[model samples]
Target: WDEEPFELIVSNPPYSVKWVGDGDATLINDPRFAPAGVLAPKSKADMAFIMHSLSWLAANGTAAIVCFPGIMYRGGAEQKIRKYLVDNNYVDAVIQLSGGLFFGTSIATCIMVLKKGKSDNKVMFIDASKECIKVTNNNKLTPENIDRIVDVFAKREEVAHFSHLADYAEIAENDFNLSVSTYVEPEDTREKIDIKKLNAEIAEIVAREQVLRSEIDKIIAEIEG
Candidate 1:
């Protein structure tokens, strides 16, 4: 039996698996990894699957993969593979999902979208870490949340605090780090303070303290008398 090329591929490959050592050096010579010119470390096989999916990806197809967050920015062989992918303009978009979205673990994960034929020389990054509703035991992506993400992904627009489209040169300037957080800025939800209001409150508190001190002095004087 033979497998046919697919137009769309989606997978949640094993998080991190040791694929090298113990006489597994032959992986370095595999055709899928040979293009990268560097094999994913024996202790980490994330790139191996990535390369394999890419090898199987049709010229016009896209592969959406769920990947461990570490592979995006980790240095060494993984970094080398990332450099190759980014340099070749195969990466499409990277989306950062918030932690606690998956069951049995709360560690954040990311999605890597790869394409063989790209329309542009840039990569779209979506910071959807907060696009989930808290359920009983885990965070689940609501339909609205999913829609919001899909809309942004499809449009490839830079939505403030949500997404950013980074050019190849920008990626190279950053050393080919594919982490979504590296490109998409998260929303700052911290409350903004009004300096004038804060100072007025401080002054009111000081006045109350002075009045209390005056009352205490009056009590002391009466006792002395």
Candidate 2:
């Protein structure tokens, strides 16, 4: 608490405050967030924490904040604040995280990485929800998992169904929705079934049924005659 402001700031803050935001007369005009009298509900303070970090960030520095999924693409004050951030070209990356990764909660979370004076105009959305491996009781990001993500972040590669470098215009077109699934889709895996084998099995069943029917008919005729 005695040190001066640093070049970079990063933190994971609580999602809610258990308090009301509308009652706070000073929060509406806060220069850190949206200027449209928009402030996050005090109960859901994830955006508030993000805005605070953004305000404290240096001109050339970055802030990485972990937040709930709602803060990324919600309406009202959230959308306004998100608009302010994205419109200012401050958002760098939005990473979707796997569910069941954190203890005491199963709600899927997302990481919002904000950079002032970022090199790229487009924002990178990475869907790393599938990058986790199941541990004893929760999903965990392994060395490989973390490495793959870091590698992607460094290179900003557009790997199909994993990551996408979305243009700022495209993001605006989507009404500022920052959900990772909106940009990066998980890889689809499906095996083609063998219709030939299924047809053969059906034919064999029909043949067996006809043979049993013939045998039954002959036995009934013999008994009657």
Candidate 3:
């Protein structure tokens, strides 16, 4: 408990595992949880790990933790902790990756980047949900995909439909929701159809069907006559 703080902290902790949370009354007073003004819920320990990482982080450290999607938008204690991080400029960036990237589950996960020393009040959000390719039965991030994500993270650029830099006011307006989708919009990949062209095609199909029906009627009349 008396070692030097970590300059970089990275972890993919057990997602949403149960923890003591506020059950251990003393945890509220812990330096890690105290600044957040509340403890993570006992049933969801995701934020607990975040707080611990933040505490152990050196003044210039950056912590990147893999998190479940729920932790990004869950209300109550988690929201309060998000507010604390955002207000204090500890949050650096949030990246959402495609589902099925991990084994045994197809649930999408997000990476939350936190820093003890930040140069700005804006938080960068990256929507890399479509950055992976389907490999066998699972999705995998190829070297190219990884490079794309890393490039955006490194430049902190605002790429349309890919990344966004949101200020504190924007986060506050959204009620402190840290979900990447809130900032970086997903690119609409659905095919664009011209309704007029589609309707014309349908009209042509119906006209051809009527002509065929008329021909059949004439053929039947000739046989009857």
Error of 2 at 12 (Å): 0.5
What ranges in model 3 sit over 4 Å off? 1-3, 196-225
lDDT head-to-head 2 vs 3, winner: 3
Which of the numbered candidates is closest to the native, going by highest TM-score? 1
Candidates in order, TM-scores: namely 0.89, 0.83, 0.86
Please give the distance, in angstroms, between residue 219's alpha carbon in candidate 1 and its true position after superposition: 3.7
Please name the candidate that would achieve the greatest lDDT relative to the true structure. 3
Error of 1 at 86 (Å): 0.5
Error of 1 at 20 (Å): 2.9
Clashing residue pairs for model 2: none
Give per-residue CA lDDT, model 3, range 1-225, as digits (tens). 566699999999999999998889999999988999899999999999999999999999999999998988989999999999998999999999999999998999999999988988999999999999999999999999999999999898999999999999999999999999899877789999999999999999999999999999999999999
**Which of candidates 1 and 2 reaches a greater lDDT?**
1
lDDT against true structure, model 2: 0.84
* Tens-place lDDT digits, model 2, residues 43-74: 78777788878877778887888888987778
Q: What is the lDDT of residue 190 in candidate 1?
A: 93
* Candidates by TM-score, descending order: 1, 3, 2
When superposed on Cα atoms, how far off is each prediction in RMSD?
2.3, 2.9, 2.6
